[model samples]
Target: MKKEIVDPNYKGEVIKHDVAKYVPETEYVVKVLERHVEKAKHNLKGAPIVVAGGYGMGSKENFDLLFELAKELHAEVGASRAAVDAGFVDHDRQIGQTGVTVRPKVYIAFGISGQIQHLAGMQDSGIIISVNSDPEAPINAIADYVINGTVEEVLPKMIKYYKANNK
Candidate 1:
């Protein structure tokens, strides 16, 4: 009988999917969660939102809208691996297969091309909104709502509208 391989690159580093491993310190995990909560509070007050993207926005300044929106919502900002690798965002803010996994109230994907690796980290967000110039961008398929437009045009309008209404 031939045994089917789960992954050709398993490489002995991954824990088995069906196996339960001891984490050794539940307190440590709790402390880390608490620290994340505190830092998010310190940075965002009551906001618990995260924005994710790639460098598809075309320019660094254009990409600033993600952070701007995050600030407006008093939320955290995150990016896909490509965004960080391309220097559009910092490594600490990278989310995806090799980065932090986030469970935020809202996950906004702005100009993100939305590779599957990027989606894996944020697919469970309570709400997901994607904005992209390309209507056919892969991320749109997974988004709860898709805004088809340039981030530059869409973000400013959104900011203005929210600011006017909320104030």
Candidate 2:
């Protein structure tokens, strides 16, 4: 029968065996494991609101204004590479091709020119509001709302409005 099964030319007789009779019966018990959730160390990643500053913000001292606005809006502060490179902000706060990526519900860019590298990190934001002095700035192109004014001028009014209405 083995020779008949192996030989292609052989007219073979078919046979069936009860393999189940020799097989062992086994049972499996599945246990659900509890999920371990870890707390995030960085507060910026999941921030609902983010306020990013760029080189156009002028000086490091100007970041105080940005921070004031961020406080009013309850937003995290982010910075472009230029701002970081200029020593205006810390490296961890930098957001761009070389920095941390963010997808905030509302991203308010102040003085950021919208360089491609910078845009890559933040373009996924749900709503983008850009405040820039230059009307032709690249950031304005992707902005849901573009405010054509210096951050110094625009931020204060915005902060005032939020405080007045949020109360």
Candidate 3:
């Protein structure tokens, strides 16, 4: 790369690269290979209930509780990007700006701090329930019901209640 002064204010101290241009070596034809798409295990878009988890859920093992709760609640599972990044769940289950959007009858957020990106995904739910230890969590502002407790403490009880009370 060759360097040159770009601004009049800057002297020899300022150096810029001489842009390089290149031509494509070859043009290749792209082919559609079977046109197969990998769909999420559950159709979150149509689910009446959605149970979403976030970074605050702690570990991947903790995420399992969400699944148990979903089963009892007859809901689909979803994750925040934070949860996906932490390897707590699969990317396909992510629900946020960078993931899929859902407007279910009931949206349950567990341990989610309510990032704007995450909120953009599920803010339109018919009912929003947030379970977080912090009362001032942003998710709480939008939640129809705010349960002030950690996921580990709250999830099992919810699961048990649903299992016992479910007809």
lDDT of 1 by residue, 1-167 (tens): 49986886676765566333545455466443343333332332123787666777666676687677666777787777777878776777777788777778888888898888888778878889998999999988988999999887888887788677767
lDDT of 3 by residue, 50-141 (tens): 99999999999989989898989889999999999999999989998999999999999998999999998999999999999999999999
By lDDT rank, best first, the candidates go: 3, 2, 1
Error of 1 at 55 (Å): 1.5
* Residues 96-145 of candidate 2: C-alpha lDDT, one tens digit per residue: 79999999999999999999999989999999999999999999999999
Q: CA lDDT, every prediction?
A: 0.76, 0.90, 0.91
Stretches of candidate 1 above 4 Å error? 1-47
In model 1, residue pairs whose N, Cα or C atoms come closer than 3 Å (at least 3 residues apart or on different chains), thus clashing, are none
Q: Please give each candidate's TM-score.
A: 0.69, 0.74, 0.79
- Candidate 1 lDDT score relative to the true structure: 0.76
Regarding TM-score, does 1 or 3 come out ahead? Answer: 3
lDDT of 1 at 26: 54
